[model samples]
Target chain A: MILKKLFSRRKEEYWWMTIAVPLVAILLALITGVIFIKATGRSPLKAYKLLFGSSGLFPSPYWKNHFAEMLLSSSMFISTGLAFSIAFKGGLFSIGAEGQFIVGGIVAAYFGYAEPFAGLPTILHLIIIFIMAMAAGGIWGAIAGWLKTKKGIHEVITTIMLNWIALYLIEDWLVTGPMKANISTGISGTPYISATAKLPNILPGTRLNISFIIIAAAVFFTWFLLYRTTIGFEIRAMGYTLVFGMEAPKASGVNVNRRIIQTMFISGAVASLGGSFIVLGILFQYPPVFEGGYGFDGIAVALIGQNEPVGIFLAGILIGALRTGATSVQLAHIPKTFPSIIEGLIVAFIALQELIRYLIMKLIVPKRSKSD
Target chain B: MDNTSLLNSSLTQTMDYAAPILFAALGGVMSENAGVFNIALEGIMRFAAFFGVWGAYISGTPWIGLLWGIGIGIVIGSLHAYITVKWAGDQIVSGVAINVMSMGIITYLLELIFKTTGYSPPVPYFGSSVNRIHIVFIENIPFLGAFSNLTILVWFAIILTVLMHFMLYRTVFGLRIRSVGENPYAAETLGINVVRIKWFAVIMGSIFAAFGGMALSLGTLSSFTNAMANGKGFIGLAAMIFGKWTPFGAMAASLLFASAQVIQLLLQVAASGFAKLIPLGFYLALPYILTIGALIGVVGRAVPPAADGEPYKKE
Candidate 1:
């Protein structure tokens, strides 16, 4: 009877465990940070005070300026996160996000600066740039996806390789080709875009602009497509298992594999939009380093968010805060690398959260009686 | 048709350029055969390249530099083995972490030690002058003349290929290693120490991958750069996969990609009237594009080892 009762309780417990685990993990990280601070001879309390305390709190003028930078940072991350989330949900780990983002960014830079159609209206130019970026990123992503789907090429290998190709292509393009800037300096980047193509700021002094709004729309659309559509359902279903029989989606007359391809394509398109946003909204030029590691960070963001849209939005903000606050903490004498350390720990903790919980349950729960 | 001249020149460049990838791909084959997905080959190569060149700069000897490169690879590979194999961490994530961490470590170390971001300029480094092979008889032979003079390591790789072929396909230990890859559970039941084999494969793989990096830093470039391994690790992985995971096949695949790269370079040089139409951007992406294309083109499946990335546990 106790066993049955315990079993029944598990369902309820699990509902809470899902939320509790990630939250608890963050708490663990913060506590660990305390230990780190103590070891460094700084008061843990003082460090925390500076890291996320009242002065660093958002909405104030000082916080406002930093918050804008965070948005710019998270703007790229959110787009990449959405990209990872989309493909991951469809049972594909598109590790080529870095490559796709770079290709997209470089191509968009070309469009933004090198076109004879520079005299076009701002909105039209933006549309053209967005389309080109999306196409470039999509094509890059589709190569990996196509390789996986067609040749059984493990995407993990192909995507990583494609990243190198993307890097070289960008570097080579910037140095001696169509998009080369006319500077004598030994830097690899394109000429700056026409002013009209740049994202105008909402707050005038801040970097927060049309790109943030575009990313917001993309997130909303991703949520709608994933949860509220038949296509999403099919894609998610295919991801669950390949063994199809009586209970298969084919029984419901839906083609699951097709949905998988469609979803990845959409994922690529969304990620590409992020590349466009970065170029059009902020950077205004394609520097090799501008690709950064946003796509890589996106994977961590998606995981921590548990692949939910609202969760992603909140997680994006949390990550934004870390990116923002890490600098503040550094300015206050804490190590600047702490944020990355925390980020790494959070990802590790979450990825292994299930196993940890299972271990805990095994330890805490008593053995069943013979009668039960 | 003067096919001899083209073949002769292409052969020489392939040996020089393909050496790094050949070593790395061979290592990948061993690790994959032993059921460990060695995706951190890129990072391993980079770490080795950086440290290998640094050691040369500090120790004033290329041999010591090469050994240091190998040692660095062993440490990085062991960490990869411990985390992914022992802790059962996600292989992909761990591999990426190693890559990221190595990049930071190398960057920081470069700044602290060398006070530079990437390239350490060519110091007075020394390695075996196996840079040229003067096989007197072959040097006098008709079309085979130019092929005689190549790096000694090129010959070493060819011999190693045969040696590996015998070791992997002919020996009892090789059979056990293959069994471990096919099914660790069955191998364990049959009394093979699967964990030990995996560790052996990873460490051995690391040593070879390190040599690949050394080839870049010591053999080809005579210097080190940040992220110097570039995509050679991925190229090695591609070669491994494209070759269907066989040692010889993988070597051939590595050569194919390396040759594609050489061709791309040559095409850039000989950008004649018609060749000018091909954008340098597109041409540069040829090798990777072909890797993707090759993956799609091959109809017969290239299956990975059954337990390729899965950590074994005795349940």
Candidate 2:
């Protein structure tokens, strides 16, 4: 009788299990963090207290500041994560987001710092930079897309290599060439964006800017595109089945090559747009390290979110909070890398947790006959 | 071209630039043949470059220090294997993890061990000069003599290529390893210990990757620097892919990419005053641009191994 009841609840419990897995992963990561703290000769409780205590991450003022900063950072992460997720969902790995992101910043910065037309207003300048940056990233991304579709070049290998090209190109041009900072010797960065191009702060004296609203708009647009558009449907179809036989489209009859290329183009544009936000909104200038490790972190965000837009946003916030709080821990005398270790543990657990659940099910679930 | 200029150009330009990538590409072939996706080649090489110089500096023997790099490569490569192969984890993630770990470890150790960050303590005679072999036959041959000032390692690379070609096509073990990559299930059904063979192939590749790293630090640069491997590992992967996963193909790709690198360096040197106009970021990005262009020309027609990144387990 209990078995019957449990079997009846199984369908509903599946959703619960999905939630349970991340919860379990988080719990396991915390446990691992304790071990890590002890191994490093720090008090785990003290560290935990600092992270969870008053004036740390959880209280009202701290929470507000933390949430606002995390939201700002999460907006950037989600944009890039969406870029990766869309490509991964379509069965293509766009590891070149880093390159696209950099190009976007370069293009945006080039425009932002350049002399505006005699009659053009600051808002117009901002718009031009945004549009140019997105277009530049899109074009950069499209090269790989075009190659993938026409020549069947794998995106993974191409993107990784392109990242280097982008890096060296930026460093060389910014440090020595036309855009080289005339004020600083041997430094590779452009001049600060025009004051008119700067993103207005939502709150006084904080880094949060108008870019957060743009990120929200982007999320909504992506969600709408994925769920409501004919092209999005075609892209998803092509993603599911690349080919069944030679020289022909399979079911849904979408042109697989065109869809793949288009998806990559959009992916690249989104990533580049994120870069523009960081440059125009946050940093106000393009520095080498300003690009940060957002690209790889996007992969983690995508995985955690299961490639869903809302899930991705939430995951990015969680990651951003961890990042912000992690620095606070460092100030509290703990090593700075503890957060990354925690994140690695979370990813490892999430990746492997399904296998563990399967084993438990196989061992514990009773076999039933159809005749019964 | 005159024989002397050709010889000088090949000696001073081509082979000098090609060694590290060629070694790394060869390692990729071995790993791919055994069904291991060797994206960690860059991380492995970087780790070796840093640690090899550290070892040489501490132990006072460059050769012994180079061997210590090989040891570190094996340890880290095996850790990658454990995560991706044994744990059934994602290969890309594992590769990324290895890269992140390598960057962190090298930076931390450089700070901890040498009390220096970004660069290492300079060891005397570290990768400074090379001895060339000039034979009467070089004068006799038209094109071959231009590459006369070839380092000992460059010769080893060419010999390794010939040896690899022989082993891959001629040996029974090579055939088995190839089969394992192609169809591990079928190979397993036929009594091959797929797991063990893969582990061996991976470890062997690690040794080569280590040598590539050592070559970077000990043969090219006198002291180690953080992120020194740059994107050589990825460039090597491009070579492997562009070479259609064959040793000769990889060598050709490596040489082509290295030639581009040499050209970029030469251009940078020749026009240092006009550097800003050149868009150096784009120049440093030449290998990627060229590789993509080349791959786009040929990738659609080629085929990789059936189970390149898929982990296998005996159910």
Largest TM-score belongs to which candidate? 2
Off by more than 4 A, model 2: A1-13, A16-57, A60-67, A114-127, A174-188, A242-251, A288-292, A304-306, A325-372, B1-13, B123-156, B270-283, B296-300, B313-315
Given candidate 2, what's the lDDT at residue B69?
Answer: 88
Tens digit per residue, CA lDDT, model 1, B219-245: 767788875887687778767877877
> All models: lDDT?
0.72, 0.73
Best by DockQ: 2
lDDT of 2 by residue, A241-304 (tens): 5433223334547677777778888888988988898888877778855546677678777766
- The window of 10 residues in a row where model 1 chain B has the poorest summed lDDT is B123-132
Cα lDDT of model 2 by residue, B1-315, tens digit:
665665456455666667778888888898888888887788889888887888889887676677788899899778766766666666666665566546545664675577675889876323454334445466535567655555556677788888888888899999998998899999999999988888888877877877788778877677898767877777777778778788898888888877777776667666756674666567677766777676666555546677787777677
Task: Give TM-score values for chain A, per-prediction.
Answer: 0.84, 0.86
User: What is residue B82's positional error in candidate 2, in angstroms?
Assistant: 2.2
Give residue A25's error in model 1 in angstroms. 6.7
Question: TM-score for each prediction?
Answer: 0.80, 0.84
Checking candidate 2 for backbone clashes, the offending pairs are A151-B300, A165-B285, A168-B281, A169-B281, A169-B282, A170-B281, A176-B276, A177-B276, B6-B146, B7-B146
DockQ scores for all the models shown? Answer: 0.26, 0.37
Question: Candidate 2: deviation at residue A224, Å?
Answer: 3.9
